[model samples]
Structure formats: structure tokens, C-alpha cells
Target: MPTVALIDYGSGNLRSAAKAVERAAADAGLSMTVTVTADADVVRRADRVILPGVGAFADCGRGLSAVPGMLDALGEAVIRGGRPMLGICVGMQLMATIGREHGDHAGLGWIGGEVLKLTPADPALKIPHMGWNELEIVSDHPVLRNLPAGAHGYFVHSYHFVCANPAHTLARVEYGGPVTAAIGRDNLVGTQFHPEKSQETGLALITNFLTWNP
Candidate 1:
């Protein structure tokens, strides 16, 4: 049994994430407990942390910082304590150095890079990059161990991670052009797609995260 913590900061689809974890755990033959709380102690005690976010990048940044001691707790839990952490959607964007959407804003800096909005040099691609897309895997990471290349996943975001270290990118998806879809470094993993909305493949990804040993 792995206790997965789904962070809540008055943003994004917390309920959906919780349900997805529970459902996936059942399918994975594992026990999972999901909850929404800013309790630093709870976050520190969690086996895996799942950061889910929605809304503007700037707003999510502020919401994360507003959670009292949560920021440090999360940092210590993963960086110092070596607990596994996964970020989804805007949650993924927060792992960057800065987000250039709306205005200049700082990110968690878990990985080098800045978050950038999807803007194609060609006018054919759409803005939000909504719907399903394939993850063109580039590296072998624990979080994506069994996941096949070209796996179709759900996406609903206007921004994506522009990793400074391209090596950190685990998968890339075509959206107007090639965009980062997933990234991983040690115990940290992030997904630009909503795994919760991505069905079986998504569940497998979550299972890998829970079972992976940092």
C-alpha cells in the first residue's frame, strides 16, 4: 500500500484526481489514500505527492505559495527526504524556473526551464491544444517504465514546459509543433497531460509512480 497525497490549494480538479488515484489503485492491486490539505506534516508523511493544478499559471503559483509551510515541506520531502512527486498540467508548469504566460512569474524550479504557451510558427495549430495526443517518449524513466511510445493521452492546457535541459524530457507530444509532454528527474515527474482523464495508460503511469523506488 502506498499513501498518495493529492495537493489542494483551492485550484484545479482535486476531486477528479482523488477518484482517479483510488480507481487506479484498485486496478493496480494497491492501497491508496488521497486527500486535500495544506498540512505540511501530512505532505511530509506522504509516500508520493501528486500536484494537480488548473487556471492561470500566475494564480496557481500564488496559491501554492499561500499554503503556509507547504512549499518548504514539499521541497524537503522530495529533495531532502527523497519522496516521489508528480505534477499534472499546470502543476507541471509550476516545476519550471519561470512562466511567461500572462506575465513573468516564478516556478518551483525543480527542473531548469521556463513554461511557455503553445505558439506555432505555423497558423494551422490551435491555441489550447485540447483533446488527445501521443507521447513521443525520448528517455527511459521509472515513472514511464512500461508506458509505450505514442501512447494517446488527454490534454487540456494552453501552456507547456520548455525544459532547459532537454534531457529531462521523458516524452514529447505534437501540438502545432513538438512540445514537452512529460519530464522526470530522480524522484520528480511531471505530465503536461491529465492522466486522470487519460484512462488505462494514465493509470499505468500512476501505478509506476507509486511502485517506483526513489
Candidate 2:
């Protein structure tokens, strides 16, 4: 069975995310171990990794970096090791090159992008784009497989990822204008919305992530 390390670095919806991944594996009849861990050694050896975050970009970034060797382990395991990784919400934002949340903050630089504040064309729209938003599939990626048309993704965040390379964006949601719903590059995939909160659409994504070869 593949061991999936759900990194616990004082951030993210750790338990719920782990449970969701477990449920997805079970539903797909796939045997996978989803362990919530803070140990870098465990992460380095993990077959797969799930990073779930819920906070400001700078705070999440600092929290992740605070864990000794955790950052290196992630780079070793995901970048060099080429293990598949899924970053959720603020977790997804961390993958960007930089985050302009409060000020300019450094990111993992896994994906070529920047985390910017959400700017809906309509001023009446709320700042934190909370609630379910229909995803507009942009690119063909394994992480988005078997998703139905007009599938809605659950989101609750004030900031959104702005991809430097447009091809990195997998799917987008319309909130007055286009908001990035999902991002993918090589073995890394991330979602701005909480897949655990999403029903069928979320389940399908987690299942695909567990079984995704790339």
C-alpha cells in the first residue's frame, strides 16, 4: 500500500484532509495509508504527500518553514524524488514563486506563479469568495479526471493564485471574472477550494490524486 504523508506543520485542516483522502482511497477500492505527520524523515520516505492549509499566505509560509527540515524534506521528496503532491487552499498558494498577501513573501517556487488578492469585476462581490463555485476546466490534467461538466468546487479565501505560465492553470471559476480553481505542473497539483468540503466533485479529485501516476 502507498503511504501518503499529510504534513502537519501547525497549519491546514489536517485531520479532515487525511480522512477525506482515506475515504477517497476506500471508495476507489485502493489501499493507501494516509498519515498526518510533522516528521521530515517520514515525509522524505512518503510515497505521496498532501498539504492542506487555511490561513494567510505569510503565516502558512512561516509555519511550514518553522518545522525543522520539513522544507528540505519536501524538496527532497517531491522535487527530487518526484512524488506526487497535493496542496490545498493556502497550501496551494505556498507552491507559487511569491505571495503578495500582506507584503511580498517567498513561496516553495514549485509552480511559476504569485498569490494575489481576489479582484472580482463586480464590486458587490464579497472579498473572501466563500461558497461553492463552478469550475471551468482549462487544461487536460490527470488530477481533474472523471469530473462532470460545470462541477462546483468549494472555496473560502480572499486571495487567488495567478499563474505566470497560463498553461499551469488547470481549471478556473468565474466570480465576475476568472478565478483560478486548480493548478498542476508535472507531479504537483493544487486546489484553491477545499476538496474535503466538496461532495462528489471533491471525492473524484482525491480519488484521482491517489491513483495519479504523474
Candidate 3:
């Protein structure tokens, strides 16, 4: 069975993300071991990794750093080992070079970008972008494969990733102008929206991630 490490560093909707992955795997007729852990050893040993966060960028960053050896373990497992990785919401924000949410906070620098608060050109649009929005896929990335047309992703965030390299942006959604829906490269992929909450579209994304080789 493929082992999946669902990092629990005191900030994310960890259980929901775990259940979503488990359900997706079961529904796809694939068996996977999903371990919700803060243990560095477990993370280092897992075949895949999922990082989920649900708070301020700096807070989440601090929470993640608080776990001893967790940062280095993640680097070993995901970056050096080339294991598949998926970051969700603020978890995805951590992939950026820095986040300018409340203050300037350093991130993983895994992907070249910055997470900045959403500035909708239209005054009426909300800051959180708290509902479903259509995903405009710009690349034929494997994680985005087979998503139905007009596919909408569940979103609730004030900050959005502005990728330094456009090719790293796999999909985008329009909040007021354009917000990054998904960002990815190599074996790493991150979603600004919550797959655990996104109904069919979310499930499809999870399924794709489970089966994606790269």
C-alpha cells in the first residue's frame, strides 16, 4: 500500500484532508495508508505528502517550524526524494518565496512566487473569495487532467499566489481579475482551494493527485 503523510502541525483542517484523500482512494479502488502525523520519521518514510493549512501565513509557518525536524524531513522526502507533494490553501501559500499577508513572512521557497492579499479590481468582490469559482486551466498538467469543463473549485482565502514563472501556474480562477487556482512543477503541486470541500471537482483533484506519477 502506498503510504501518505498528512502533516499535522497544529494549523490545518488535517482530519478533513485525510478523510478526503482516504475517500478518494477508496472510491478509485486504490488502497492507501494515510497517516496523520507530526513525526519527522513518518514523514520521511511516506510515499506521498499532503500539507494543509487554515490560518495566517506567518502563523502556519511558525507552527510548521515548531515541529522538530519536520522542515528538514519535508525537504528530504518531497524535494530531495522527489515524492509527490500537495499543499492546500494556506499550506499552498507556504510554497511561495514569501507571503505578504499581515506582514512579510518567509515561506518554503519551493516555488518561485509571493502570496499577496487579493486585490479585486471591482470593489464589490469580497476579500475572501468565499465561494466556488470556475477554474480556467492554462496547462495540460497531469493533476488537472480530465476535469470537466466549467469546473469550479471551492475557495476561501484572502491571499493568492502570484507565480514568478507563469509555466508553474497550472490553473487560474477569476476572483476580480485572476487568482491562482493551482500551482505545480515536477512532483510538487499545490491548490489555493480546498479539495476536501469542493464536491465533485475536489474529489477529482484528489484522485488525480493519488494516481499522478509526477
Candidate 4:
């Protein structure tokens, strides 16, 4: 059975995410072990990794960094080992080169980019870009398998990732304009929305991530 490590970095709803991934694995007929862990050793040994966060980028980044050897473990497991990894919401934002929320904070820099405030063209558009929004598929990826363009997912964030390489963008959403919904490079992929809260579309995405080979 594959082991999926849901990193507990004191940010997001870890239980909800664990339950969602558990359901996703079961529904996908995958024999997987899901563990919500803060221990670096457990994360280092897991076959798959998930980083989920729900708050400000700086706070989440700090939370992740606070873990004694968590960052180093992830670097060894995902970056050096090339294991498949996923990030959700603020977790995804933390993958950027830097995040400009609450101040300029350094990120994991797995994917070269910066997280900036969403600038919706329409003044009437909201800042957080909350609620369900349609996804426009920008690139073909295994994690997006069977998910067609315009699929809706739940979102709640004030900032979005601006990929330094346009080719790294996997999906986009039209808020007041084209807002990045997902980004991917090699074995790392991230979604700005909350897959656990996103109904069927979210489940499908989670399922895809679990079974994705690369």
C-alpha cells in the first residue's frame, strides 16, 4: 500500500483534509495509508506528500518553518527524491519563490513564482475570490486526468500564484480576469482551492492526485 503523508504544520484543518484524502483513496480503489503527521521521519518515508494550509501566507509559511526538521525532510523527500507532492490553498502559495502577504516572506521555492494579491479587473469583484469557480485547464497533467475544462472547485483566497514560467500553469479561473487556479512542475502540483470542500470536482481531483504516477 502507498503511504500518503498529510503534513500537520498547524495551519489548515488537518482532520478534514485527512478524511477527504482517505475517502478519495478508498473511492479510487487504492490501497493507501493516510497519516496526518508533523514528524519529519514519517514524512520522509511516505510515498506521497500533501501540504494543506488555510490562513495567511506568512503565518502558514512560519508554521511550516517552525517544525524542527519538517522543511529539510520535505526537501529530501520531494525535491531530491522526486516523489509526487500536492499543495492546497495557502499551502500552494507557500510553494512560490516568495509571498507578498502581510510582508514579503520567503516560500519553499519548489516552483519559481510569487504569490500576489488578486487584482480583479472589475472593481465590484471580491478580494478573496471566495466560493465555487470554474477552472479553465491550461495544460494536460495526470493529476487533472478525466477533469475537463470549466470544472468548478471551491476557492477562498486573497492572493494567487503568479508563475515565473507560464508553462508551469496547469489551470486558470476567471475572477475579474484570468486568475491562476493550479500550477505544476515535474512531480509537484498545487491547487489554490480547497479540494476537501469542493464536492465532486474536488473529489475527482484528489483521486487523481492519489493515483498519479508523476
| TM-score winner between candidates 1 and 3 | 3
Residues 63-180 of candidate 1 have per-residue lDDT tens digits of 9899988998898888899998999999988999999999899898889999888897779778888999878888988888777555788998888898999899999987767989
Candidate 2 lDDT, 1-214, residue by residue in tens: 7899999989888878888899999999998888999999999999999999999999999999999999999999999999999999999999999999889999999999999999889999998999999998889898997886668999999999999999999999999799999999999999999999998899999999998998
Clashes of each: 0, 0, 0, 0
lDDT of model 3 at residue 28?
A: 96
What is the C-alpha local distance difference test score of each model? 0.86, 0.93, 0.93, 0.92
Q: Mind sharing the TM-score for model 3?
A: 0.98
Candidate 1: pairs in clash: none
Identify the runs in model 3 with alpha carbons over 4 angstroms from their true place: none
Give candidate 4's TM-score. 0.97
Off by over 4 Å in 2: none
Q: What digit string (tens of lDDT, one per residue) describes model 4 on residues 86-152? A: 9999989999999999889999999999999999989999887889998888898888878745689
